[model samples]
Target: MTHILQIDSSPRLERSHSRALASAFLEQWKPYHPGAIITHRDLVRDPVPYLDATWITAKFTAAAAIALSDELVDEFLAADCYVLSAPMYNFGIPAVLKSYIDYIVRPKRTFAVTENGFKGLITHKKMILVQARGSDFRYGSAYASMNFQEPYLKTVFGFIGITDIEVINANRLNTELRDQELAAARTTIQALAATW
Candidate 1:
């Protein structure tokens, strides 16, 4: 059975737009792929610890010598696909999500630094990010220049070898156009759920 890793990073709980979109997608996806395994990781409820001296040292150490936090790493590696639900905070991803990224982007595990450049060890995996932003950040929008969320996520995930990334942006959540934005997002979610 295919395994899907679902990660929810919004701290707003039930009121979070990204969470709603993610849930909608998952609900549609289940019927399409019966017997698929879904693993949910709620960062707000159980946050991953920040990487410090010990973690950093362990990261550089040889696999035989150090006991890495392999549980999260293993979960990430085992997944055939991923659904990340996040709210844009300060024009970037939430701290809890970033912390989870730090944990999964391991050296020699998820990526390797070759003589030429960095190469991503991960392959053939797809990722879907459901982002809820307070303002419009789509290309050609007035505030697109201020959007660090999508770009940062793309860069970091690309560095780790996940290039087949799709983003479903629910923009302008704090604006007067909130309802319209959500409706559009729901439409997009329905389409992706049908195909993805």
Candidate 2:
């Protein structure tokens, strides 16, 4: 059975374009895969704890390994796919989403160092990122210089073996091109939903 992990990071409920797109994607996906199980995590409503001294210590020191906890590990490993809704904040991902990443990307838990260097623990998983931005940042566009969200997400998730990532960007939310960007994002989501 396919188990999907859905995470929404937008603080705004009704006003968030990313959340709306993600909801649509989920609604569309459910009918196609009727037996698929979904696990939802709302980062904005229930914020994840940022990494602190204890988390840092537990990560580096092999002595305090029990502090890492198996529950957290199990939660992540339970999913076969992930759907994330995130909005660009200050040219990057929101703080809440970053905090959630920090919680899940644990050393010796999600990744490990092998004889051939570092290897990602979570493998053969697929991911979809619904990114909402206030400005245009499509490839080769003028505002593309400011696009850090997509690349950053790709890099981080790739490090954890989630290389099969599809990004549907709802850009230019604060610009005159809002409607156009949203339309393009919707098209992309529909295409991805059909194949994913």
| Best-matching candidate per TM-score | 1
- The TM-scores, one per candidate, come to 0.95, 0.93
Instruction: Estimate, for each residue in 1-196, the C-alpha lDDT of model 2 and write its tens digit.
Output: 8999888999998899999999889888888898999988888887866777776777677556444345545777899999999999887899988877876776777888889987888899999999998877889999787888888999888887889998888878999989998888888878888889
Q: Give lDDT: candidate 2, residue 161.
A: 82
Top lDDT: which candidate number? 1
How much lDDT does each candidate structure score?
Answer: 0.89, 0.84
Model 2: per-residue Cα lDDT at residue 195: 82
Which digits, one per residue and each the tens of the lDDT, describe model 1 over residues 37-135?
999999999898888876787778754423435778898899989999999999899999999998888888899999999999889999998999988
Off by over 4 Å in 2: 62-70
Poorest 10 consecutive residues by lDDT, candidate 2? 63-72
At residue 152, what lDDT does model 2 achieve? 90
